[model samples]
Structure formats: structure tokens, C-alpha cells
Target: MGKTYLYLLIAVAFEVFGTSCLQASQQLTRLWPSLGIVVGFGGAFFFFMQVLKELPLGITYALWSGLGIILVSISGWVVFGQKLDLAALLGIALIIAGIAVINLFSISSPH
Candidate 1:
């Protein structure tokens, strides 16, 4: 993978971690956990900003935000016993496909 993709991955990984931590942080009861989430999110956003240098804002942001939401939701289902029905799963799949299409086929990307 290219540097841009690597950076994007880093951002995603950190963001997922942060989001998971946020869940652990319940109503300020888990202050330390919440602090960790803030730190993780800050780092992820920093890497995301770096990735933006090599890709179009619309394309990069679309994939980043879309994939991140799906991953976070999936994580919630798996880790927290949250309900994920067929529709949500299919929607996540569609989002992934959309990101793939944007990255692999669309000439709309500035890169």
C-alpha cells in the first residue's frame, strides 16, 4: 500500500480504538478510559489530516467517515452485544463497496 493508504489505515485503527474506549467511558464514570479515548482520537485525527495531503478531500473523507462508522458499529455489536440486524449489516457492506468503488474506479479522486 502507498503511504497515503497506510496513513489512512493508521487513522482508522486509532479511531476505532478511540471509539471503543469511548464506550468504555460511561457518563464520566470511567474518566481514565475517556481520557484515553480523547488521546486516541486526537492521534487518529492527526494522521487523517496527514493522509488528506495525498488524496482528494471528498474521496478520502467519504471513505474515512463511511468506513469508520461501519467499523465502529460492527465493533459495538461484537464487543458490547449491541444489536445488528440484517439491514445494518447490508448497509455496512454497501458502504464498504462504495468506498472500494471510489478508491479503485473513480477518476474523481485528485490523486
Candidate 2:
């Protein structure tokens, strides 16, 4: 159980890192950044796949997708200065609640 969440965290970190490099790749107009994007996304996906191997599919996907949403929203605000309106904030909150529910009450998990 701990190991599964650790892998999920790694996947989220890779995804966040990859997303942060989006601007660099967008502006560089070179081959290196493109390659980096490819490899970064590939690595992130690999971690995500590994996460799914030991967890229930529904719970795993929910957590993965929810974490991605929350982190990406934070990244946008931090890196892009995008304001989160009340509605947007609420939406993110809902996603977080959904993840918490899965963690606390999911009967299907091996944990």
C-alpha cells in the first residue's frame, strides 16, 4: 500500500516536472526540448502504469487523475499566474475530496 502510493507520487512528480518544462520547449523551437518532452511524458506514463499494477483500477485511475488535476492547477497558478476563480477552486476541491474518499473508503483496495 505504501509502495503503491509512493509510485503514484513519483508519477505525479514526473508529470508536474514535464508540465513545467512546457514553456521552455514551446519557446526553444529546437530538437532537444522536443526530445525532453517525449522522454518526460514517457517516464511519467511508465510510473503511472506501474502504479496501476498493484492497485485496483478504479481507485488507481481516480487517484492518478485527481492528483494530476490538483497539481496541474497549482502549477498553473504558480507558473502562469492564472487566477483560480471560486468555481475553479471549488472544482479542484471536489477532485481532492474524491481522492480522499477513495483512500478512506475504497473497499476494493488491497490495503
Identify the leading candidate in terms of lDDT.
1
Q: Which ten residues in a row have the lowest lDDT in candidate 2?
A: 19-28
Ten contiguous residues minimizing lDDT sum, candidate 1: 102-111
Per-residue alpha-carbon lDDT of candidate 1 for residues 1-111, written as tens digits (9 for 90 to 100): 388888998898889889888898986589887887988799899999998888878888897888789889988989998998898888988998998888778997744
lDDT of 2 by residue, 15-104 (tens): 776766675577658677667667767788998999888987787777877898888888879987878999999999999888877778
Name the runs in model 2 displaced over 4 angstroms: 27-33
Which candidate number has the best TM-score? Answer: 1
Candidate 2 clashes between residue pairs 3 or more apart in a chain or in different chains: none
Clashes in each model (backbone N, CA, C under 3 Å)? Answer: 0, 0
In candidate 1, which residue ranges exceed 4 Å CA deviation?
none
